[model samples]
Target: MPLHKVIYLSNNAKLYLWKITEDFDALFNQIRLKDSSLARLQTMKSENHKKGFLAVRMLLQHNDYNDFDLYYDAFGKPHIKPQGCSIKDVEISISHSNDFSAIVISEQKVGLDVEQIKEKALKIASRFMDVSHLENLSKEEQIKKATVVWGIKESIFKIKNEKGISFPNHIFEDDFNFEDKKATATLKFNNKEEKFKIQFDSEEDYIFVCAFESIKN
Candidate 1:
């Protein structure tokens, strides 16, 4: 399976998804990794996690970039070296959960998250979201909606990539209709408030969310 799916988050941003159907060795053999990537891969305790890491590299290569071109900052945020004399530095965000790994590359700052839909996200809904939003949905809908909210907050946090941002305390998602397949959130921290635009979709029981910092914020 080359790519599970691709979404154009915007004119300048494209999101890539890889379903981890291949085993670790199958994925590992298809891509090249720098020494640091290899070291980081070795430190992962879970095979699924290792595969996720490898799959991210695969996606990078798919875009003509390799592991050598990727690096991380002190906050563990992933970055891509500006190639040539491009005016805007290319931005990237990576996330994986269970069986899928995802990456989004953009000229604009972007954040991405892929989540496996399960009972756990719903069970902890109260800890991070306004549970009242779940009141009218069926049990199944509740689970999916809760997962989306969590993903929204996660993606926004990735975009901000700063310290002391609390999901429950700082990130707030406005009420949105499921039919809309879109949402907006507000981040209020450090006495500063910012807004973000979010888009999400479900694929094969997994939810993928993308966050872009609002230009006005």
Candidate 2:
């Protein structure tokens, strides 16, 4: 079957989700070879990375499959040019797991991440959460709370283009019912605060959360 596509447009940003259907062998053949070293391991990780790259190319509307060049920043984020040209002032991030790959494109610096919620959520809560957040929730409420918290933190980290921001300390989300389809998050940075609305969509077994800065004049 052909892959599925999801597009989200808001705040001058475009978010695309591509659902993969090709087998690993067929997908691997689509990858371009840079050198003899490219012919190595056909492992699952390598296959997924190829699919993720292809998905981004499709989103960018590349006509020829091999007619693009990808560059990376010091942090290893992918940047694209049509064969050999470059587009300026555009930022993008790509993420995938299991069956889907997602990409976010924006005119401003943006951060995007998608995570599958798991039972291990509770175990990792303390590492990302701040005291006030812990005090506000009971043991049973922690998992869902942690997922939203982590998403917000990840989005901010992507925006800031750095890591190690303590959630509930550097950021905070107003009280929200996780069962709701959407929620808003407020982030505090350097004594200034910005607000964003987070929307959720469930695809198969994973939840996708997207947060972007509001378009302001």
In order, how many clashes per candidate?
0, 0
Q: What are the per-residue Cα lDDT tens digits for candidate 2 across 1-217?
A: 2436555656666667767787755555655544422433334366667666555555455323232344566876665553335445666666776577777766665666777776466687766665355466666566666666677677766666545456657766766666775667777777677877666666666666667675566
Assess every candidate by TM-score: 0.96, 0.70
Model 1's C-alpha root-mean-square deviation from the true structure amounts to: 1.2
| lDDT leader | 1
Model 1 TM-score (2 dp): 0.96
> How high is the CA lDDT of each candidate model?
0.92, 0.62
Model 2 per-residue lDDT at 111: 64
- Quick one: how many clashes does candidate 2 have? 0
Task: For model 1, give the 10-residue run with minimal summed lDDT.
Answer: 81-90
